[model samples]
Target: MKKICLTIIMGLVIVFLNGCEKVLEKTPDGQTTIDKVLNDFARSKGLIDAAYNEVYQARDQIAFVFSPLESLTDNAFWAATYNPYRWHNGSLSLSDPVITWDWSSPNDQLWSDFWRGIRLANNAIKYLPQSTVITEEQRAEWIAEARVLRCWYYMQLLEFYGPMPWIEEPIEPNYAGWNELVRPGYDEIVTRLESELLDVINANIFKPRVGAVDAKRVTNGIAYAIRARLLLYNASPLNNPENDRTKWQRAADAAQDVIDLPSYRLVPMSEYKRLFIGANTTPVDEIIWRAWTDNSHINNTNGVDVGSYPFASISHMWNCGESPSQELVDAFEMTNGALPVTYNDATHTTVTVTPEAAALGYSEATGGDPYSNRDARFYINIVHNMYNYGVPYNCTEPYIIETFVGGRNGFNDVISQETQRSCPGYYSGKDKQVKYWGPGNSGEGNEPTHWVLFRLAEFYLQKAEALCELGDPDAAATALNVIRERALQPRIQDVPGFANTQEFLRERIRNERRVEYCLEGQYRFIDQRRWKILNETNRFITGMRITKGGNGQFSYQRKKIRDYQSYTDKYLVMPIPLEDAKKMTSMLQPKAWQ
Candidate 1:
């Protein structure tokens, strides 16, 4: 019986989540009996936590995701040649560890890891209901958490790889072979998620929330947020080529459900950046879900590494990681609520400042203090030329960051030394919770950190997007304005010469998502794909050339950093790994990959 139980434990592949540290006293007893796991509340709860651990971070899992998924999008560029560059550099293939999710190397393959999570959840859903020791209330709550996590994992799978095989329960040991596990249709996946998973979660089967103590743990809010996000993706032009208003309505309604949740509210503008820095340490009012671990905090780990990544003089990072793009820099509106540069095309030429912005005496032209007087969010999000960067991990105060060729944080054209100096002319201030650790430490104080996943702000944007798709730009404007209000920017209705046409409003909402959520996650990467605008947006990552003159003045020239040669169709959805797909005889690759 002991041998049989050990097999079940090993075969099930259950690993615990973020809070498991408190659950364990010392090294886990490898010889513990399975009956304890089944009957003991703590052990059984750990099984459910395993499902949460399997879900990888889309933001920054340095070794796991190479660079944050932003490297694959126009938001930022990762100077070092890592896995993300492999995809756009034409070296991506099925054999890559990222695709295969090689267990030996502990990779983050969307395919294998998600299934492993599903299987773990299947085991939890199976055994948790049979618990003899825990109360019915405890059982219901724990099991509900597992169910939502399983569905959320599937939602991510759908986002990355399109439709997938639907599995409701654990597979029997001698169940149907791999050949039987073929892909299903997109509609089938969506319907099943809506009817089976999302409906149940929305009905509040779980606790009101996981709460502040475990802010990173999955919650009912997260389930609702993911449902809305998935529906929005489903209604996007890429998925809803037929322009189905029904899909758009569903997305809108789902987003509205999130807004109706009583426990959450957008943190005031004062508390905005506090969401990522763990500054409050209390549950952030806006955050619904976040990534958490004992050792590493989300405090701008993206550029925190002061070692290799140019810009931050405070972090102790090993690799030259992600830095923001000039294209992203230009996305921020001026303080007067107009784009600083109006572009005629994606080529980024044929540009001029908007009359409204120009009238305010703002010019992003080649040279002369262009970084000043931008949107309120711009100062928080970017570290541009002649900007001050804050809080080195080892220091208590902020420092000036220079992006000139030979300045403190140098900007250069050489590819190999990309990490030595920033590839992009500017660094993302928001992504760097701390500039560096040792090089620029003030030796005064320390800061807190956390990772925000689902926040109330995103749902508002989703509602706005869905409303825009449903031909209700007026209602969409209301939702869009909520976000703008927090940013201290003027409402859409107040912008000069504003038109509420669906075409114009849609661009406003999309750009809102771009600037508001930049460096937060893979939202921009997936947003461009879902909207089918990848070709236009992913082509060129632009940078600025800052040359300092004899008078110690810096002149700025916008230049194309690299032409992304591989922004072709296969990127619409990642290709199924060849080895993994072959196991299922009839599996279909995404249309573009095929």
Candidate 2:
């Protein structure tokens, strides 16, 4: 009887150990095993494509990544009760779950999503080496691509949370303390990211551009542009305590690397707007890297960036979330490349008549048509009161946006009128219009906007900025001219009242970035932080209050919309999430976050 019991126990132990081994298997859930993926080139390609799909898969990819964050800067306003709004309004605490220290369960929050991407990249890198079906050269190239994708994830994290816990190797789910891992210092994180990117560049694995099949894949130009941006951030006041010139030089050189690449150039001014809103397959040389999506995955609903539209135009389902502030509207230079509309005070409601604005049919005394006689991009980027966009290709009647009080689509008027009949921009057939996509019978509008990641124009701006910092304003002006001339505006050197001093060039570069990249991403907020001008530039958000008289005359007042007076140096580097902070008790929060 004793011998029989011993045999049963021994058998049970063997079974238990086998089950444990099965649990530790390397195959990811819902994915094929590494052995199977590596044995076939088709499977390997699918694996790579899976990583790409993961990036563009977020339900609110653009809003989550870019739009809502615009509220943090002077460029936009967000009224929605979303994570980004909470962060923008400074309502987030250390205990906020989305950004907190607890990393146990991987949710779809920004922190978790990015960390998951890093894991996918690491897994791909690990599995690619085992492939016997592909050439060694192909394996090396694919591995480099994986590393670049990983670097991209890290870059996004760096922008929001500053230094994150760097994950060099793939951590198993069962690994102890994986949830509470502590992060390295800012410098250490930057160093590792720079090293990884350089290794890929040195390997010559990425191309300056990719074919249509691989439209948005990480390329040599994209990698270099990111490196340039990262170096610029590192060299800025936010990171460089001593304001290092070497870092600036490094950044300028990296940007030049992309500029030297002969594959890209600016699209004509005529085609500039189409680059963002055109069909998915429409080729544009200006886009360096984009999160490409097609009609099947397109924004069928009104949610991609509904905030970009005026409040009165959208239907009942969507709210006007993002509107251009008066500050942003004034940043656009005059048609002749003159200074922005001069204001009597910070209110910006009263414009001091300039020869430039008047030359383009602006009236100085009555605050002239603030929208008239601005850069061509202003017409493309913003929709102001009473501006009539040309007739839609599908519709014979031109669409006029009426945002004045008591007018159709007026913010206040629409609120009082329950019936949307008060809104009269267009009832249907808006796709023919170039600037907007209004709600039709289906309560939906489609505007296929590609969230541009990097472009050739930005590189020129980056080069111009670094050169200015290095006290080469002449060279900087030459670089800035590349964009200005492309926009059909006078070169900075030719502008009548323009000064050649460093101070003048610095302001010019700042203005150029704000106008060129507004509503595209977090560039405005990040740039303000780096330049240490949050107090002056981001403190009080402003918007236009439009009142339309019975005579169809429009009146405007630049009102201070939100008082973000709480902004300070600490906001420059966002704090680590609360739950994550709690788990890693020894890890210190970013300076002043404590």
Candidate 3:
């Protein structure tokens, strides 16, 4: 009996939506069959759970939903030779290891990871309806869950790869023409995905979302948010070559659907930081959807603290990587509703001082603290010179970060001598930072860190963006103000002397997204590509310089970082994975790649 059970269990392969694995009961006898497993609700549920787990599975373990791909964009710079850095430096090719399957390294194959997820979901969707052990309602709900995962996987593939072959049914290994299968165009892919999402939404299959028990599962709110984001992506210029206004309207409507959800609201500014950083037993109101973890806190053990946090924070482990660029720092507006402060050596003693310096409540004319009195979100998102790094693990007052040239955590400082880049600095806030020591401080990289995949704040900005593109600046400003109000910053109209023209409003909306969603994921990259502004806006990324003046004031200079290269048109869309492309003769590489 034990031998039979071991053989049956070993032969079984279950895929969960979250992409995590759990143990299942071994077969009582050697006669276990697919039909028998599907007939048992417990066994079928195990399969569904496996599919959910697989959604976040990268190689052998679950990874942050917001992959390090965020670093590849203008918002960040990781000094390593990974795909993110390679993509950022414009050194990526079709044959790059990231775009080509490295069979030896499971995590290196982004293409296959997502494809595996899609296949798992497809298998569940195909089998669940046929389960005799579960009632129709159970089947409907489970299938809906699987379909949502399927749509999500398709979106992931489509966004980076552009126009993947639509797979509705499970494909067998012996299926003919597998190698020659050609991907559909953008329109067909979007249309099919839209239809599938709507089917799930209208089925009334998901639950009203609440705390831990239901946190990871697909809910009504998550489904709607996915729909809203999909519409926005479809309306983007890269996908919508015709510049369709109707697409924008549809996106606005979809976003409004999320806004209309009673369960979703931007958590108060005081509670905002907790959404990303702290250990929370229950799901925060702001998060519409996220990758759920059984642990009370999301783990940041990937050296997120060491990478994004500055050395001055008194971090326990290796610190410093994924530094924010000065260009991103400049995107933050002044508290007095003025433009970003610029460098002027003649009138201003330091480059950090803006025309609205007095209004910013800073007493230092020498400008040692460059980030003084900027938009409130700046405090939440960025780590600049003299900014506080939250309460220390030792329970002291927040440590003031020093990223200036010779300051404690500066680029030229001895501790960071290996990588001497600028120090405008990027620091994740207390909510995102690990305030306590993990066992052996080995948990420094493994500290709980959760990814807020979708939040109410994003939907507000999404609505504003769609409105602006549709030529309704006034209405757009209203939507934009929702986020600004939450951030406690001056609203759109409050910026004195600023024009409300569509062009001007468009710039504001773009800048708002840049600062609002920096390093959260690929929001900056998507917005730039969607508007086709990478060539214009990201032509040359900049870094800041901090020099000690004769009178002891810090003078700043914004200079281009070395070895950093701005991306060209080709980067707007990544090439199809080279291995997959080579297998299929009809496979079309991204136009830029060709």
RMSD of each: 5.5, 8.7, 6.1
What do the candidate models score in CA lDDT, each in turn? Answer: 0.69, 0.62, 0.64
Best by lDDT: 1
Model 1 poorest 10 in a row by lDDT: 1-10
Query: Residue 245 CA error for candidate 3 (Å)?
Result: 1.3
TM-scores of all candidate predictions against the true structure: 0.88, 0.82, 0.84
Q: Write the per-residue lDDT of candidate 3 for residues 1-594, one digit (tens) a residue.
A: 000001122134432211223233344475677777776777777556655754542211222222245455666654534444445567667766343333333334456656766866777787777778887777888889988988888877776767788876755433456466786878778778888888888888786655656667887777788788888998988889898899999999998999998887787788767776634346678887665542213223222233234333333433344567766777888787776565564222245544565465533335545567688878777766666665535444455566656665565322122243333344434234545433234344323455667788888999998999999999999999998888887888988557889889888888999888886665776787778877766654456666666777776666555333545878788776555566566877878877
Give the per-residue lDDT digits (tens) of candidate 1, residues 65-176: 3457777788887675556566567655555534332233334356655666776777778888776778888777778777878888788788788888887676553444
| Residue lDDT tens for model 2, 381-475 | 66666667543223345556666655444543231212222121111111123334444432133355565667889889999999999999999
Count clashing residue pairs per candidate. Answer: 9, 13, 33
Number of clashing pairs, model 1?
A: 9
Specify the poorest-scoring 10-residue window by lDDT in model 3: 1-10
Which prediction has the highest TM-score against the true structure? 1
